[model samples]
Structures are given as structure tokens and as C-alpha cells.
Target chain A: MENGYKLSYLDNLESESIHVMREVFAEFEKPVLLYSIGKDSSVLLRLAQKAFYPGKIPFPLMHIDTSYKFVEMIDFRDKIPAKENVNLIVHKNDKYIKKRMHPSKFGMDKCCKFLKTKSLLDGLSSGGFDAALGGARREEERSRAKERIFSFRDQFGAWDPKNQRPELWSIYNARINPNESVRIFPLSNWTELDIWHYIKKENIEIVPLYFAKKRKIIRRDGLILLADQFNSPKEGEEVEEAMVRFRTLGCSPCSGAVESEADTLDKIIEEVMIAMNSERENRAIDYETDGSMEEKKKQGYF
Target chain B: MHKEKDLLRLVTAGSIDDGKSTLIGRLLYESKGIYKDQLTSIEDIAKKKGEKEIDLSLLVDGLKSEREQGITIDVAYRYFSTQKRKFIIADSPGHVQYTRNMVTAASTADLAVIIIDARKGVLEQTKRHSFIATLLDIPHILVLVNKMDLVGYSEDVYEKIKEDYLQFASRLPTHDIQIKPISALRGDMVVKKGNNMNWYDGRTFLHYLESVNIVSDRNLIDFRFPVQTVIRPNLDFRGYAGRIESGVIKVGDDIAVLPSGKKSRIKSIETYDRKLDKAFTPQSVVLTLENHIDISRGDMLIRQRNVPEIRDELEAEVCWMAEEPMEEGGEYLIKHTTNTVPVILKELRYKIDINTLHREEKKELGLNDIGRVIIKAQKPIFFDPYVRNHKTGSFIIIDELTNATVGAGIIWYPSATLPETENSQ
Candidate 1:
């Protein structure tokens, strides 16, 4: 494509999204971006940078950390915010963690509710934020497919799919009553290819685990799981060496890696192109339950 | 260089079962848009799912339930660009239940690619898709009769289906509609021109999409720029922020800010670091007015020669997206451009029969229904016809109670009650 005249598909999508993000800044009283150290979030961050060029991102960046993420992700998170000079607020489930709550007790979905959603809500409440920008895409899940670009949340932080606001044109109503907030998804229109193309075009840095690496793995729930020290294997569960990489990143307990030899960006993208299954197919937690994502989203997981 | 200024946005309508996902997957794949690892993961899934060939559908069927149930539930957007033009493609689900998603995708599209099962020529859902595309006023439409290889590359079959579609689409409001015999599964008439269809002289799907003349689609003479926000960085500089809704504005040209009717000259347009000598339709910039005016967010900057209609009452074509039908005399918040005002539905003119292009005079319209309504706003909105400028003509109805968007509307006329005083004189 002629770079100047004809916009690459990624370029046009980026233009529209940047327009939406600027609208978010113009309409909302207080808006913050929920920054998870992942590909989608990285793209969102870059879009924000482009949106307000010459001016720093008008909003702050918040991360609802479960404290079980890869250490490298957190390090990158901290360093980028400083490098960009974006306001950073690191939030964790301090109270729940202090109580020594385990994922085994309440299950993966509920654990996400307590440690992720609750912490995010807490941050919103204290900061008096009326709207928060998220990096979630409809292609991520079924329930998410029904999500709006400017999704409304009730006073109790519940998403009534049946009661979703109609989003038409580019005109977004960012109005919310007390205790209620909105989740603005600028990347709602971007696809996996768009994301990868954008990453390649912009040379956006992502965590190393996304690239294939030889790591200790365990066979659990018929999937190869990344062997984390925190989640020790139960009796008779054998651990072995496997070349694995993660499609998505989250708490170590639920997120699983697929065995692959594709280490470079080109190789990983080629792998994605030929793959015929959903990205979440390999995640152990998803296979064990149904509507797990919907339940978590209802509780306000970003 | 002249053609590059114009671009087309398209949406594809179908379900996972109909191979809509595979069609898009293959389109991206053949265009060299897919990455290596993504392809690797797709291969692994194909093996796990026990498919004979790599299931390209899995690449776009990203929803959890959709994947498990083998269906597509929502609008999944996919983007790919060619040398001649860029495209923002929205792949919407085919099910009747997710019709709202279809409406959302169709609202902004300049063209629609309606995919059909070759075995089931012109089904009920096919009509529904075409109907919505017409209602949205999409300038161009393409019917892809997919899975043709299943029918042994039968030219007779393709012709029968195309004729059936043309007969049905005769009543549609669309201007330019084309039909192509394609097998999204076998790569026929998609990225590469099909060799089997020697009788068909038209360009392949990708070629037609890239070459279609879109420069004349937009109304460039009517100037409309709805100011989003005011940007004042230093003591000496004062700027009005917005994307050009229609027409163009150049430095030193005189312009009028709407509602206020304050006139000012454009000093310069600044986009981040660069100072632009000229700005046109769709370019977002901060315009430095020659003099400090009373313009703020929601104010419009337009050429005095082509002023838009300013009125309190609006007659519009609305696509009802909510399960709750719009009630007569019901009030809601309407956000058009940067302006948000409370609006009441004065009357339900008539509901549209999407399939037949018939008008159903009804008191109520339900979910995924299209209707024309007369509305009275608490405040007047300035605008042009949707054909003149989509940016200023389009709006959304937000539920005052829930803040959910219940309807999407494009203005038709101001109202009958409002006295037509000639402002042009």
C-alpha cells in the first residue's frame, strides 16, 4: 500500500480508535486506562500516545495486579509508564491477599472477581473515575462480542446485556450516574492480524513469554501448563521440558502455554495464521468451566 | 494520488457455520496479513478439533461460546489494505438473534459483502442482510455465492442464484449492486480471479473493492465541521478542535461558527507538531481562528455559503437496536456530533419492511426494526442530509435511565410545524 495516500488497514483502524479515545477524554469527567501488560493493552497504550501527540496522554494508567503475574511483565509495566511520563497507579488485591485467599477455594472465576474486579472497583471508587478505558476486544470471547464500545455499567457495577446502550456512528454518550462507570474499548474493532500488523509496524515491545522458549511444563487438564513455583504440581503430575509460549497473559494458575517452536515474531504470526482453534483453547481454567468469562465480566473484570 | 483520498468501509454478514469466518481468514491469509505463530496456533487447533484441512474459521471465530458451539455471535472486525485503497471490514454474525450487531456494522459501511450458501440460494437471512444494507443507504453491495465447488463449479447454479438475488433486490434502495460466484473455501473469486468463471468478465472480489470509484460519494461542497473542543496552549494562540465533517477549509479562508453565527478566518491548522496549510473532510486538527470567538465544544464551524439546517424538530430514519421499542412521547438523550440534548419521540411515522421495501404504518417498532420517527428536541441541532454529510446527519438515542444506546437515527427533515423562513435570502 502507498503509505501516504492509501492507509493500511491498521492505519485506518488506528485513526478511528484514536478519534474515539479523544472523545473519551473530551466527554468524561475523569477517565483512566486499565493497562494490563499484554498485546492488546500495549496497542491501546500506543494508540493513546498517538491520540494526544505533543501532549501526554490526558488520563492516568491503572493496573489491577493479582500479584501472580510474570515478574517481567510488571517490570516492563513500571518502566514504560516512566518512559512515557504517563500517570501510573499500581493497584493490588491487598486485603484479599492479606487474608491468604487461594484460587482453589473459590475457583478461578471467583478468584478473578475478588482479586481483579474488586481491586479495580476500589481504585475507581477512590479516584472518583466515572469512566475507564479498557483494551478488551470482541474477538476475545462470546460475551465480549456483545460488548459496546462505550458499555454502560449500573450503580452496582453489573452489565445487563439485554439493557446495553445502542452505540451508533461515532457519537458516544459518556454519561453515568453516581457509583456507575463506563468501560470504553478503543480497540473493539481491531483483529488479531491488525494487532500483529500494528506490532510489526510500530515495533511495540511485548513480554518475552509470547515468543517460544524452552520452559518447564506440566500436563494438567489435557493441556501443557507452564510450571510456576507458586502453583506446585499435585502428586503424580509429571513435569517435563517443552517449548511453549503464551497467547494471553494473566494469573499463573489459570493461563496455560502451548508447546511451539515458533520463537520469532514472523514464526509466531505464521503459527497464528494457520491455527484453527480459539486462542483460549489451551487455557486450563477455561476447559474446566463454562461461562467463566461471563461471570467474571459481570463482576467487573476489565 | 487523486484516488487515494477516497476509501471504502465494508462489512461481511454470515455465521461460523456458513464459512464466513473462513472467508475472512482466507482473505487476510492470501493478502499476506497473517503472522507465522498465529498460523501455527491455527494449525494446532485444526489438529485438536480433528479437522481434515486447517479450519480457517477458527482464526476469526474468537468468541468462547461461538467456538464451543461452532457459531459466530457478534460483529468481529478484520482489517486489510491493498495498494489502491484501505479497508475496515466488519464481519458480522448471520443469526437472526444478533441482528443488532449487524445493524451496528452496517451503519457506517460504504459497501456490504452479503455471503450466501450456494446450496441455499437467497435464504431468509439473505433477504434480512440485504434489507439492512439498503436501509443504511450503503452505496454499493456485492453478493458472494460461496461454496460453489460443492456444486461442481456449475455455471448454471451460479446464474440461477444471481438471477434470484437480482429479482429480489429490485426493490432495495441500494444504488450499485454486483454479484460474484465465489467459493471462499476454494479461493475462487476472492483474492485471485477464478479461472472457472470465464463467462464472468467482472473483476475478482479484491480487485473490484480496490478499484471502485468512491471519490464522488462524499458531498464536498457542503462545509460542516462540528467543533469537538477548544485548544488553547499559549497566551497568543487560540484554536478550535474538530475533524472536518464535509468540504474543506484552508488557511486565511473565512468561516462561520454555527448557532452563534460568529464569523472568523482560519489562521492555521495544527495537527500535533505540523502546521497544515489546508485541511479537508475527516482530518482532525486544531484550527487557529483569526480572532478569539465564543466557540466551545459542540459548536460547529461551517462555510457561510453552505449553511446546514438548524431546527428543534427532526424527522429521521432510525434503526431500533434495543429490545425495548421506542415509545411515542418517550424522552431520551441524543448525542449528535459533539452535542448532547434531550429528545422526545413525537410520532412513529412508519416501520420499514426490510425484505420487501414496504412501509408498515405501526405505532410501535421492536428490536432490530427500522422505522421513521418525528422527534422534538429540547434544543435545536444543526445539520445536513445524511447524503450530504454522514457525520453531521447521524446520531444515537441514549436511554436517560440506563445510558444505553437504544436507537441509531439519521435525520430526514426538521419538522412540518416549524415555519420555513427563507434564510438563504
Candidate 2:
């Protein structure tokens, strides 16, 4: 994608991301890229490969699995590490899983705490990772729009939005104690459309679930949820089939797919251009309450 | 896809009451960046707050304290785009204590729009922001004379404000200044030409933002590439990975590694997906050399004859960032490009007053204090004068104990060295 004479827009984005990766590598000792096996996560993985060039990504990538991700995504995650030659680690809250804790039983908010956020907290604490690169982009959500590239977290892994340090220019303040972890967003400035464009241009492989397919979906709590183990039809509820694709990926229960026929990258780009709804609109967690994303961010949710 | 290189990074500077947030809200609304669902959410929030008008203060100010207090506390980055260009605004607070945040937001901005109330004319905060924008070397400045409605859309008020701001800006080192009249509340001359400001024939603020020519500001003659990491994906290739801070590099051309001064010929230019024939400023690439001499991070690659100043000691204008006042002989970590060196602040020359532009003798600099200080790095670090290049010239000082970034330094002058290149702009 790089042209010697003129830098393509994608090239510019890639260079900026690579610079961020190098900064994280230079600054922190135990840094991990939080791989969710989504399109954005795929872009980050490849960027890390290109960032270090001959050297492998110095730190391992960890996925705080809630054990409720799409089957295709889990398969891709398991198979791609060897091909890419990047170290990958997966951690799930086995305690919560063993206790049969479900979002339906313990409320969606509390369920997320035990399944995703608490598991991530446990992973970082055990791994001793001082810094973790998140795949969050500013254009996704409102609270994300205000985030710094190198976002600072306190000793308890809590984000103080008001007390965040000022990041001037490319100079990031990675200065923190050993116990305090820094959440870095190398893709902070990238938009959702930018991610799709880079994916198609680089020919990077992502899960085929992003493309439109006929899936059994049910309407629950004003959300289109996939009919999976975590989300089955309630009594008297009907399961509907439709050609849908996920704009943003997460656990199957919370992630909603849009009714899109965009089976290819070009079609998706065209569909996204004319669409009025943002990708963040598809996430179930963001709609729990007003400023829910900000509320979750304060409690150390990515 | 239309490969348009029209991304504009800008900063908005003004006091809290000058409708800074309102102007940003207008820009977002006008650009259609605020989607239908988001607008609905904002309306819902506004209704809950019992606000008759849409309060944009909720949009930019995400922190609970800021929203309750109705003031911005930290720098928040907001992104919006027009058909022509993508815009990222580092929206920093205008509080005096948060001057450090202003400097941070303005550091990487190509342009700055410092709003001044048309009714109040140019104030002290206006002058302070203008000075900081100038000191940061922002290529473009727009003295946004907002609230034209309050002045009855008079031609004289706009003219007087422009004259006063220009007179104040004259003392500072800022050029390429543009002024526009607008009313963020009534929406005059923000995105389109409002009927009220018939006297103002110039482009709207958004139009000006889309068309500002920043191409000529970058140094393209002298090539400077600071190596960040070496890319040796396998034994078959040895690529010097780095972002080209300035100028162009081509294949088969002779280049020299800085500090070591080792000369080699370019074998190939490696990019992520393919090989590049040539590369220019700000494009990160992996370059392979013919000889494959020892090259790693912290070493720079430039055109054979043209090189930057290599000095162990430098005098710079540093904006103190930490709460602790800068100690004269304290050892700190200095990060410039891909290099980090232990350095000591030898002396504090003086501090500059943004209000008066006076050189006041100061013992130490605390938070948000702008001062000139002499620093001695443990080893020779390569740099350019801040006036010429920002990437090669700028650096940050880190407190060793706290590991906090204590100061931001811009090299004012390099030590006595040979001016080898006559192609200086």
C-alpha cells in the first residue's frame, strides 16, 4: 500500500499505528495486544507484525474470553496463531463458568462484570502486564471519542477519565507504577470504515461471519441476538431467519447483526457509506443506560 | 477509492464562556458526523436535564464532573469529517491550571482556531492562546471572532477585533493567520455564509479548514529518517524500519547512518504489502542497504551530505509538565524520535510570559511553566531546530523516579556545528 512518491490514506494510518506500537514496545515491559479475533483485532495483529518487521511481536496477545464468542471466531483464533507465528494466550473466568452464572440470571450488567471485565482484570493481574493495547477506535462510541492514544489507568486498573494525563503530540506518558496498567489504543484514530478499507486492501483474512449469511436470530430486550447456547428462544418466542452481518463483534449474546446483504468488502463499504447508524449502535451493552459506555470505562471495561 | 490526503489536525483554544463547545457541536452537526441515533440520544439527555435547547456541553465533556460543573477539565479528542477532509480536534480546556493540556493538544496540530468574543474583543486568554499556538509552530491560525449576533453583525466590530488580534499577534512569531466572523449560537458563517454577515465575503470557518494548504510547510529537501526498529523478518532481508521525518529517500541512492556516519547504498525500499520505489516525509518504511552495516533503533538515516546537528548538550524551550518544579541539576530521561537518553537540566535561563512576552528570570519552573533550559544528554542525540522541523527537533523529559513525563522540550538552538547543507529553508 505504500507509495514512495505519495502516501496513500491507508499507508498514513498504518504508519501512525506502527509508530504507536513501537512506542509501547519501547516504554512498557509487559504489554499484550488484546485479541478479540474480530476485524479490528486482525488489523492490530498484522500491524504488530509489520511494526516489529523481522522481530516477532515482543509481547504475547491475550484474549479474556467470556466463552460465549461465535464458533467461527474461536476456530479462527485457535488456528491463526501458528500461521502468523505470534504468541497467543486465552483466559476465561472458569469460576464464573463453573458456577453457571448467566446474564439472564444475574442481570446483564453484573454478568459482564464477572464474565468479561473481571476475567480481564484477573488475566492482567496474573500475567503482570503493565500495558495492554486495545482494539477500540474513537469512532465507535461516544466515550471512546474522548480517549487518548495511550490511556492511563490507576493502580486498581480503574480509568479516571477526569484525571487522565495530557498526551501532547506523539509524546505519550507511559510513566506508571508496576501495579498500574496502561491501556493503549494504537487504533484510536481509525474509524470503522478505515478498518474495512485496510482489511480489503491488505487482503487480511477475517472470520467469514462478518459477511452476510442466514442465521437464526431472535428479538430479545430490543436486540437481535443469535440463537446460541447463551441465547435460546424463550417460551412463546419465535426464531427468525435473515441474511445478516455483524458491524461490530463481541460475545454472541450481546452482539447484534444488522440485516445486510453485504457479502463482500466492496458491498460492505458501499452499505456503510450510506448508513446513518454508527457501529456502536449495534452493541447491546452501550444501550443499557445513558452514558453506559462511560460508566463501563470508569470501571476498567474495554 | 479516492486517495485523498486531506486529513487536517486542528485545535480549538478559548475560554470556557466563549462557546468553544458550541462551535465544535456546530461543526459536527454541519458535517453530518452526528448520526441520527446519536442526535436522538443527545435530545433524550437534554430532555432529562430539562434543557429547552440542545445542550452540546454534554457532547464534548464526557466526564461527570465536567458536565456538572459545565467546564472542560482535560483534553478530549473529537473526530469529524467533511466530504473534502477529515478533522481531528484536540479540544483542550481553557483553564489557567490546564495550560499544560493546551500545549499538549496544540503540539501536533497543523492549524489552530483561537476563538475570541466579538463583543469583548481580544482578551488576555486570547493573547495567551495565540502565543502558545505560535510557540508550538502551528502552521495555520484562524482568529475566530465568534458571537457576531451580539455585535449586531456590524462590520466595524469584526474589523476592530481583527486589527486588535493582529496587533497582539505581531509580537508573537505566528504567520499565515486567517480571521472569520461567526455566531455559534445562531449559526452564522460557520458552515455557510449567513445572511447576517453580508460584509464578510470571506469563506466560512469550515470551508477555510477544508482548504488550508499545509503542503509547503514541511521540509522536503533535506531527507531525515530516524530508525525506530530493524525489520529482519528472515535472513533473506535486513530492512531499516523507521518513519521518514523529513525529505525523500530513493533506491540505489547513497545514505549515511547518523552518529556512526557509516555510508551505504539503498538496496530496496520495503513497505508493508510491497516494495516502494521512493518514500517521502512522514511515511514509515523498511529500507534495505547494500552493505548491511550495524543499524538499529536510535540511529538515523539521511542523505549522504545533509545531516542534522549531533550534540550531547542543547538549549531548548521546555514547557514544564509535572507538579514538581524543574531542578537545575536533576537527571531525567530525554526521548527524541526513536532514541532515549539520560540527560541533566544544567541551568534554567529564564521563563517567558505569554501575556507580556517578557523574559523574566526564574529560579524553577512548575506545572505549565514555559522556560528556556540547558540540558546535557548522556550521549550525542541528533536533532534539528524547532523552527525548521518538529519531529526531529522536539523531545520530552521524563522524571527518572516517577517515570512521569515532566517536561516537553523543543530545541531552540543546536551546539556549534558545521552547517553542511546549503539547502536550508
Tens-place lDDT digits, model 2, residues B1-425: 43365567899999868888899988877776667777777788788889888887677876666666777777777877767777778887888465798888889899989999888999988988998888888888998998899989999989999899888888776478999999999999888787998877899888888788766777787798887777665888787777888888889999999889999999988865677788787777788999969988789998888888888999999999888899998889988888888999999999988788899998988889999999988999998888788888899888878777788988877546535452232
Error of 2 at B425 (Å): 8.6
Residue B392 lDDT, candidate 1, scale 0-100: 87
Query: How do the predictions measure up, each by TM-score?
Result: 0.82, 0.94
Judge candidate 1 at residue A58 and give its lDDT: 79
Highest-scoring model, lDDT? 2
In candidate 2, the residue pairs with backbone N, CA or C atoms under 3 Å apart (3 or more residues apart, or in different chains) clash, namely: A4-B278, A54-B232, A54-B233
Q: Model 1 scores what on Cα lDDT?
A: 0.76
Q: Give one digit per residue, the lDDT tens place, for model 2 in A1-302.
A: 22235555567778889988987887788899999999999999999988886568888999888988888889899997788988899999999989987777887788898888888988998999999998998877777777889888877678877666666667666778769889999999887777887888888999988899899899876678888777889898889998988888888888888898999999998887677888767787887887777887888888
Q: What TM-score does chain A of each model score against the native chain A?
A: 0.94, 0.96
Steric collisions counted per model: 36, 3
